[model samples]
Target: MRQSLFVSILHDIQQVNEYFIQTRDATGAPGLSGVQKMTAAFQILQYGMPANAVDEHIRIGESTAIAALNFFTRSIVATYEVVYLRSPNEVDVARLLQEGEQRGFLGMLGSLDCMHWHWDKCPTAQAGAHTGHYHKPTIVLKAVASYDLWIWHAFFGMPGSLNDITVLDRSPLFTELTRGHAHTANYTINNNVYTIGYYLVDGINPVGQRL
Candidate 1:
């Protein structure tokens, strides 16, 4: 059964766009371009076939199909970064913590878990990395906290191939709080260090920071 998660994906993409429209001044020009279309055509390649099949399914010329997939992939990746690639706002975190404390989340404004997103498999790369050791190749990760949980801050995208530990290693939050000499701005809350909040929760991998 060939199902299009297209509508759902588009909805997610729009959520990211809405973030920019609401929080920051709109910059740059209008919509996606021709090359972007090619990128979008590349999306079907994630289904485990080469370009031609995707083209046929979409009823597009080979080239045109490639263009759309290419466009969509790049634009979508950018959209992910735009929507999810940062920390949640302090205000949002505070509100969530308040509600969660009452609900048994217990200072649980933050959350952490692994997620796998499907993607195209590389020629030699084992399907395991992409598919969670299963059928489809995917980007896997442990994501902590959601934009919905936090008002002012955002959580962004990690590549499908990354585990939670790797994602946190590349995170800005870790560097600011745990690495090097910690400073005042490291834990700023309303211009005064907020001590009430609990720490971000993630993995207990050997690579993770130990208290």
Candidate 2:
């Protein structure tokens, strides 16, 4: 993240919740600043560091670091969820279609893929169900990302034991299409007109199939 963007998010989060603000201890000495708290949270998130690991660099205790991370994530979602975590609107669809046309794909929305993240702290009892070809407990995250690097759709928390096809079957990416609430994308390809937009996917996913 850029310095300006991080500062912007920090400022917004500070406004949304006072938990991130700095305060003085009972001895009248200054305590941890907002920067320290936010930095602790960011370091843990960005590097997947343990709570106690931040103590060496940020001077935060394990419990306090964990609390800061929880509060920081909640504050971010509460402040920016409506604007940044939603389905694309009509204008967004139109722009995407135009970009697709310019790129020689008449109605392509983006690329679809799945990634597996190792679950280091997975419970032993449930580890068998989450273990996949990677031979370890993991979680899957399926996403559709456009050319501009914007993620249009995200579905997470699926077991790594499931393949991309199984994950797609359970994903809500096509919920709008099934409910007839999706925007129409009219385009011509080899004299055939396609009304629905399409996402580019690897061979693992069946082509010419729409939900």
Candidate 3:
């Protein structure tokens, strides 16, 4: 993550959770600062480093590092989940539609893609089921991101053994649309009106087996 973004997240997390705030020890010595705790947690999360490994760089013990990570994650979810981790509202849909029209994709919402994250310590019993084209065990993350890099939809935890189509079939990404709870986007292309918004995908069959 960029340093500025990391700093912003750290600042927000600290404001919402007192656990990240630094305090003094009983002997009048200064304890770990918020930066140290957040750094330990961020390193473990971004680099996939073990808790014990963070001590070498951040001077944090394994247990403390683990605690910091847990608290940091919980704080972030509590603080930002509502705004950043939700389906697009009407305003969001309007903005997306306008941007799409400007880009010659009148009814486009975003770009859809799947990513595989290597699972280094997968259990032996489950390893075979998680192995994929990469010849390694991994977990799949299906996401829909807008032009500004804002991920409006994220579905994760599927085994990498599943292909993009299979993963999409199992995801809740279209649940809202299927239930008619999705925001409607109406646009005209070549004088033809389209009511539903679409995501730009790769190597997938067209909807309803038609153009």
Give each model a TM-score.
Answer: 0.47, 0.84, 0.89
Query: Candidate 2 at residue 16, lDDT?
Result: 91
Error of 2 at 56 (Å): 4.3
Q: What are the per-residue Cα lDDT tens digits for candidate 1 across 64-161? A: 56655555666577766544555555565566666655655444545554556565544445654444444566655444553243222323545555
Please write out the lDDT profile of model 2 over residues 11-120, one tens digit for every residue: 99999999887889999999888888999999999778999999997999999999999999999989988777778888999998998899788998877888889998
In candidate 1, stretches whose alpha carbon ends up further than 4 angstroms from where it belongs are 1-48, 73-85, 116-139, 147-167, 170-173, 179-211
Model 2 misplacement above 4 A? 1-5, 46-53, 203-211
Better of 1 and 3 by lDDT: 3
lDDT of 3 by residue, 51-97 (tens): 99989878999999999999999998998999998889999999999
* Model 3 lDDT, residue 70, Cα: 97
Find the 10 residues in a row with the least total lDDT in model 3: 202-211
Kindly give the stretch of ten consecutive residues in candidate 1 with the minimal lDDT sum. 202-211
Which of the two, 1 or 2, has more lDDT? 2
Q: Residue 86 of candidate 3: its Cα lDDT?
A: 86
Residue 75 displacement (Å), model 3: 1.4
